[model samples]
Target: MGDTNSDSPTASPEAAFEAPPTATVSLREDQLQNAVSFLSHPKVRSSAVEQKRQFLQRKGLTDAEIEEAFRRVPEAPAAAYVPAPSPHSVVAVPAGTVTPAGYVPVQQQQLVPAQPQPVRWGQAMLGAAFVAAGVYALKVVVWPYVADAVTKWKASQGEMAEAKALQEKESNALAEAIQAQTSELRNTVELLQKLTVSLEASVAESKRAAQDSLSLADLRAELRTLAGTIREQRPAAAPPAPSVDVGRELASIKQLLANGVGT
Candidate 1:
């Protein structure tokens, strides 16, 4: 049976495989848009051509979702894909200037007349003579007053400048005096502070010394009272002569007893 099966014709793997599917997998509209946007990227456009489903998978889409999206992409019309115009390539003409093909540009309004006619040479010469006369009169009559006014203004300005300089000098001197006074005040304050600190220390020392002296005086007084009390508590013994007489008498008695009493 094995030898007979081996001899029989076997189907090739390629022949057994199913044909390429024509029907696209159904996908969401948004997924289809995402696939189109990914392909529209400059880097994706320049990359080696691959299956659209694989490209969608690279864009973080699931395999099943990519298959669904790929199905709908073929249905999208090629004419619907419009290339984005470059900013530098597109030029805009003014709407009023551009006329449609075979379009008659009807007049919107009648044109206004040009500016008034040019003046004659005689009138120009007369106007120039009047200006020259006015200039000459102003030079003879008004110029001296103007010059005087300008000179006065300059003199006043100089006086003001001098006054300002004097005021600035005075201010500087005053500032220096104030600074010196402030330094002197600071030194005086420091000296007074030192004196005050020393005085406070001396006072404290004096207070401590006074307290110690009071304590010493109280101790001395206590010692004097204790000495007086001890002196008062001491018993006064009888006269030393009587003590000697008693001792002599006791010695006489002892001699008599040694001699034998009655005999």
Candidate 2:
């Protein structure tokens, strides 16, 4: 019982005791105020109070939510006017103009615009030659050949189509004739069988008929006589000169065109 005063008020060496942490707190109020101030500035374009109310109404926000928003809002000063430059031209001060004291001079100069250089004499000559070449092509080189080619192509294509058609018709007729000759040969074989039977009957019944049958000498003579007749009367087809399709060639040539300045 010498000094039983444990509850006595004594200054502790440590710092003051802290309360139970209900929420975190910091010295960030100025930053929060600044952000709100920026949002509420007069020049800053933002939805009006009525608009925000309508938006919150459309969102089905409670009156309590709207009140919390109004409380968090901050006020700011109205915007001040700032000058802007014109795009058409710059305002220039004269060289001898005087300014206020402590006004720093910015020694600025505008860059000079560059201009195109003149071409050399040789280049000029080349340009003239190119123009002259274009003129010469139109006046002297192209029209005559084009005209000739057109005439030749039109006529040749017409003839070529006709000739091709004629050739096809002739070939068809020739094939028909060859088929007729084959049929005739078959019929001639049947007739020759009857003739052979008759000739054999005559020879078997009469020796005079066998005696009238041509000898090998007469057969040889008749064969020689027929050969002479074929040699004298046969006609020859003059070998056709190899033909070229000039119409197609002319058409191909005329269709080609040159491009660029001289074309």
Model 1 lDDT vs. the true structure? 0.62
Model 1 Cα lDDT, one tens digit per residue, 111-150: 6789999879999999999999999999999999999999
Off by over 4 Å in 2: 1-108, 112-141, 197-263
State, as a TM-score between 0 and 1, how close model 1 is to the true structure: 0.39
For residues 48-104, write the lDDT of model 2, one tens digit per residue: 667655644454444554455456764334689977654444556678988768866
Clash count per candidate? 0, 0
The predictions' CA RMSDs to the true structure, in order, are: 30.7, 38.1
> How accurate locally is residue 116 in candidate 2, as Cα lDDT from 0 to 100?
88
Worst 10 residues of 2 by lDDT: 11-20
| Candidate 1: 10-residue stretch with minimal lDDT | 11-20
- lDDT against the true structure, each candidate: 0.62, 0.55
lDDT of 1 at 141: 100
